[model samples]
Target: MDVTVIWAAIIALGVLLYVVLDGFDLGIGIVFPLFPDEDERDLMMNTVAPVWDGNETWLVLGGAGLFAVFPVVYSTVLSALYLPLVFMLACLIFRGVSFEIRAKANRTKHLWDLAFIGGSTGAAFFQGIALGAFLQGIPMDGGRFAGDAFGWLTPFSLLSGFGLVATYALLGCCWLVAKTEGDLQRRLRKLVWPLTVMLLGFIALVSLWTPLQDPAIAERWFRSGLFWRLAPVPMLVLACAAWMRWAVHARHHRTPFIAAIGLVLLGYAGLLVSLWPYAIPQGLTLWEAAAPRESQMFTLAGAAFILPIILAYTMLGYWVFRGKVRHGDTHHYH
Candidate 1:
């Protein structure tokens, strides 16, 4: 195995971790406005409050790993999506601030609640837009970014943004079902089927749009000898979605959430496989975008130690807080 490939996989793992962990919390925020009952809303907030900040750590790891291991890819992609990235960061900041202050503000709690929802929606939208733009392929001329600033704003990007909003909200709904009881749980149960249908529709659209947008992706998946082997990917994703819907209907709260995570993981796997060897799809290969070997080696050593600690603590935190978030119960960070 090449060192560059190892680093690429490490970054991909970090990205997957961040998407799965932070994604649920972001989805919770996106669906915050749906529950008008203050008690239910507080329970929803309590479900994620203990580890929301820790969940974000995987994102930082992903970003830092990309910058360290693939400087060219980082510089190029970041430069191309500069404005949206800035907006995403701003939204994240607002969301974090709102999380810390919302409970403290007795009179202005609604204002903070609004900010949280807005920030979560904005962050998820722009992240999806950035992803869509990347899938549409970067406008590279002589190995440099040659597109205009607003090139990221396209029909596909907009659709992708909305798609992610639905996807995240579905995750949130499933999570609430797993982490709450009584009225809140029942309410979330009703949302699971509709959100599942909506998510499947979005996934279908994106799946079609992705191949059409990039001939390489289309050819790689449809025309290659590897196509038959990889064909099960979509099938498995859909199967998970179906199982999640069934689980929610059956009142198997934990099953629905687990199935939801599985669905997202399958989709992520399909994507990484589709774009394998290319850090910046259609342009830069992993080796091409990788930094100097010395830099990679140095960071590799640090990652070897730090990633385990992060993983350990993350698991421990979840284990500690593993229970239903009941209404009127005080949520303590132990």
Candidate 2:
């Protein structure tokens, strides 16, 4: 292991961790509309309130890892994704404000909830667009994006954006099933059927698009044996997703959320197989964009210890707040 490889692994792990942890909370926001009544919405918000902010720790780590290990890549990517990045950040701000305003304001909490939903949907979709564009490779000059501001506004990117929103909504709905009880659980269960169908459909669309857009991907996928190696990931994901659907229908709330988390893990594993060694999909390999060996080693020293502490704290938080949030939920700011 080279220092660059070590740092790349660290960065990739951080991104995956962020996705698995924060994704459901974001999903919850996205699916807030699916709930029938106002109280259900509040309960969904309450379910995520305790742990959502904490889940963003991995996002910070991922951003910092990129700055430390691959500043060139970061500069290029951020430049390329300037508009989508702004959209994502704006959504995050609106979401945070929604959380704050909803708790503080008594008469107009509904507005805040709507704000949160819009923000979450906007953020998640724009992020997917960013992913689509990165995979599609932007033209670069001197390690910076050399294209129009609307460079990411492609048909494929928009489709991926919506797909991500759908995925998050499904994740959120299942999370509600897990942490909620009574009416909320029932409502979430109702969502499982339609959402599962949407999830499968989105995956199918992405599968079709991937090979068509990048023939090299299809070639590499089947030729390098990576596809076979990674086949178990999607197989396990689908199996778990099926079990989750069944669990939701069977009125087993907890199992569905667990299965949903397993699917998220499986998705990350599949991505690792799909795009290993590449920091920017088809364009930049991790080693090519990685910082010097000494710089990477220095960052690892801090990351090695900090990441475990963050994980421990997150797990402990979940352990402590392991229960359904009732309609009349109180915010206990820690």
Q: Evaluated with lDDT, which candidate comes out highest?
A: 1
Query: Tens digits of per-residue lDDT for model 2 on 180-206?
Result: 877667767888778777877877787
Pairs in clash, predicted candidate 1: none
Q: Name model 1 segments beyond 4 Å from true.
A: 331-334
RMSD of 2: 1.9
Off by over 4 Å in 2: 328-334
Taking all chains together, each candidate's TM-score versus the true structure is 0.97, 0.94
Per-residue error (Å), model 1, residue 310: 0.4
**Candidate 2 backbone collisions, by pair:** none
Name the weakest run of 10 consecutive residues (lDDT summed) in model 2. 325-334
Reference-based TM-score, model 2? 0.94
lDDT of 1 by residue, 187-250 (tens): 8899888888888898889888888988999999889887899888878987888898679768
Compared with the true structure, the alpha-carbon lDDT of candidate 2 equals 0.80
